[model samples]
Target: QQQQQQQQQAAAGGDGGQMTEFSIALPAACAQYIVGTNMVNIPTLSKFGAALTLLRDNISGDVVFSYKGSPSAVAESRTLLMHGMNMFGVEIRRQQALLQEQLQA
Candidate 1:
């Protein structure tokens, strides 16, 4: 299991779970638009996808993630992936709030 995780980390451009150097191949469109003028359409995207879009602001066309040996590794997470993951949480809260408002109405 540890070996498998090492391989995954390597594939993700991290050296033994540290992302000091690696290649992140995003689509040409994403690369251009990550630093482009067009507004990202977030509503149509999945929460995870939307969060990744949010990372475009923090990352200078460079996305990063970190993993500790913890079972969940929540603390070791970097801003980009954490923000991307937070997108889902935000979406869920928004939906719940909307549902509550509708019920109140």
Candidate 2:
């Protein structure tokens, strides 16, 4: 009977368990846009995708110019904003790449 119990315990992998799930809250601004109150999906998204989504949602609203501006001026401002967004996208990509490399190591 003791031998049989030992065999059973061995087959059961010695009681080591599965990983646990974790959850975190979203920031106020992001929570407002998120469909659900839960933020479990944030960690699952690719860094670049998350950054792009953030940029898209942020700039979706009207772009307010302080004073009366020419068409060219408004276009210039928009272009600058887009350039900054592109930089953010690049940074996110780099961060993801570094994370992947670390995981492999």
TM-score of candidate 1 to 2 decimals: 0.28
- Which lDDT value does model 2 have at 28? 31
lDDT of 1 by residue, 1-105 (tens): 999987997678666555232224443334333323222333212222533564655555434322333322333233433344455457568889999999999
- C-alpha lDDT of candidate 1 relative to the true structure: 0.45
Write candidate 2's Cα lDDT for 44-65 as tens digits: 3222244335544664433222
**What are the clashing pairs of model 2?**
none
Give me the candidate number with maximum TM-score: 2
Error of 2 at 61 (Å): 14
**Number of the predicted model whose lDDT against the real structure is largest:** 1
